[model samples]
Target: MAEESRKIIHVDMDAFYASVEQLDNPELKGKPLAVGGGGARGVVAAASYEARKFGVHSAMSGQLARKKCPELIFVSPRFNRYREISHSIREIFFEYTDLVEPLSLDEAYLDVSQNKTGMPSATLLAREIRQRILKTTGLTASAGISVNKFLAKIASDVNKPNGQKTIPPEEVHDFLMQLEVRKFFGVGKVTAEKMYRLGIFTGADLHSKDEDFLTTHFGNSGAHYYKVVRGIHNSPVQPSRIPKSIGAERTFRENLSSEIFMLEKLEGIAEELEKRLGSKDRAGKTITLKIKYSDFQLQTRSHTGGHFVSKKAEILAIARELLYQQPLRESVRLLGISLSNLNTEQDSSAPAAEDVSVQLRFDF
Candidate 1:
């Protein structure tokens, strides 16, 4: 099928977890709140805007959050409630377009180029959707409208906390030229520092480099930087959710019964996990080790902490403890290591600024 212009919109709810708590309980509104525990070992899952003013944020230790905001209130996470609301929000997206790719419970990408309502203006569509979300859920959402996913995602951050931004078709070039490299979608702290060393401080600086130069310094990710700076992202919004966990598992044909042998296999599994995490520069505090016995009985052990770890050595050290935490009921047939609680829950990698030629105009 021949395609015309593309209109991608990224909608992100405002402090989804904390907001939901506030909606259900009127007392939590307009106060510094963290949706986790207030105990010394508690890890924060989310924070409200009031809490953000005091430097409290998600994934931080609850002890630190309390230190940052003395009056901050902490509540246990209600994941089932969150999932329920997230389902309702997705229903709203399906009403607009079928190309709904959920990044998490709080955000999604909508391809509205050919929408159900036949709206010609992506900007207006975003506004309408945000309004609908606010009316139905009693919560606010921010949206970004652009010709592709990359620009759309970044644009959404420009005006946040119940606001929206649009990068019109003709304005894409200038926007990229003026953007800071640090704000580019995939550029994390480590990548940004490396780019700075190469004297690439902004989109204009990144656009000046050739693919070869970037590839040499950054490996495969450099090619991504080169294309993104030139408004050339071509990845589409797939209709699925961002992965909840990333893992590597191995099945042994011989059903090893020895713990020593399991340790050897775990080292190799950890190596694969490091590669997966490094690919996206993601770090997480939660690690789970899955054990499948010869009899097909499955068991899982998990540990979560305040700091994030992405190295093989760090991951293997934890996996080793979980393996010896108890006696194996039977010979193990499969062993796996998975990491969750990632820092990049809201991060997405692709969305083209337009067709490669930039000839397609996003209709209004």
Candidate 2:
């Protein structure tokens, strides 16, 4: 028997944080605005459409953003307000289907193949969802409708800032063939450059390369590229997806070479990780340390303990070991710590409220 096709929709809010600020403050609308810290070492969390016109964007340094748009108004992010709005939006989604996978506070992938509305057309459903969001939240959202998550996500960005696009199953092949290699999902700058060097500038070029050839050139991910280029993604929209890891990272204004300075930075990173784990009431067995050198090279080191680790002291101790286990290779510009192999089961020996514990494991 032939397989049944799935209907997927990817919804993305337009400049969510900055737009929320503008919605609350009417005077801020139509002006260049950014939401983030305004300190010299601060980064822009979000930039309004107006700010983007002046080349301002999210994750840009406050100093550089100001230089780009001298009149850019910087407003601190109100995460609580955003969360409230997100909850309201999610309620709207549940009205359609329970199979909703949230990517962030403002974006989600919805499996609307079997929906409550009994709507036969995914495009119509996307339009209805976008309209409902605008009506209920006083915010606009863009949506993409397709047969799978990968195609739906790409379609959503076609006509952005309050628009919707749908790629029917029959049109998938031609649409993908014309797509630029860089626009495909998971094709970052490095991968795109590699493709360009290999004369794979478009999906058509990528499609011409056989599975074996791509695998030889790109490893396991090469097989993924081979499938996606031919419009053959089968990844599902899983609503119950739990994060495999939690992490915190920071980039310094100046690179540090001294071991003493690196340790001090690791302490702060560990504290941040502890706070994050505490908020989620989560503990993990493996701790991974990530470092980015001034030249942008990245390195990671991990140690898995026998017991779950969540406490500040435990996290700090593990992080300290990971940092000093190896000699400094170069000046470091970024530092990060992450916890994986999360403990989801309850423990009886540990405290009744916080039953988190750890077990020793191998280190590499």
| Structural similarity to truth (TM-score) of each candidate | 0.72, 0.85
lDDT of 2 by residue, 161-215 (tens): 8998888877788898899999998899999999999999998999999999999
- Candidate 2: deviation at residue 204, Å? 0.4
Q: Worst 10-residue stretch by lDDT in candidate 1?
A: 351-360
**In candidate 1, what are the lDDT values of residues 158-276, reduced to their tens digit?**
88899999988788888998999999978998899988998999888988899999999989998788777777677788895556678999877578899999999999999999999
Q: Model 1 compared with the native: what TM-score? A: 0.72
Give the poorly placed runs of model 2, Cα more than 4 Å off: 250-257, 271-286, 292-318, 325-334, 341-364
Top lDDT hit: 1
Candidate 1: list runs displaced more than 4 Å. Answer: 1-4, 241-336, 339-355
Candidate 1 colliding pairs: 149-351, 150-351, 233-352
lDDT of 2 at 28: 100
Q: In lDDT terms, how accurate is model 2?
A: 0.88
- Candidate models: Cα lDDT each: 0.89, 0.88
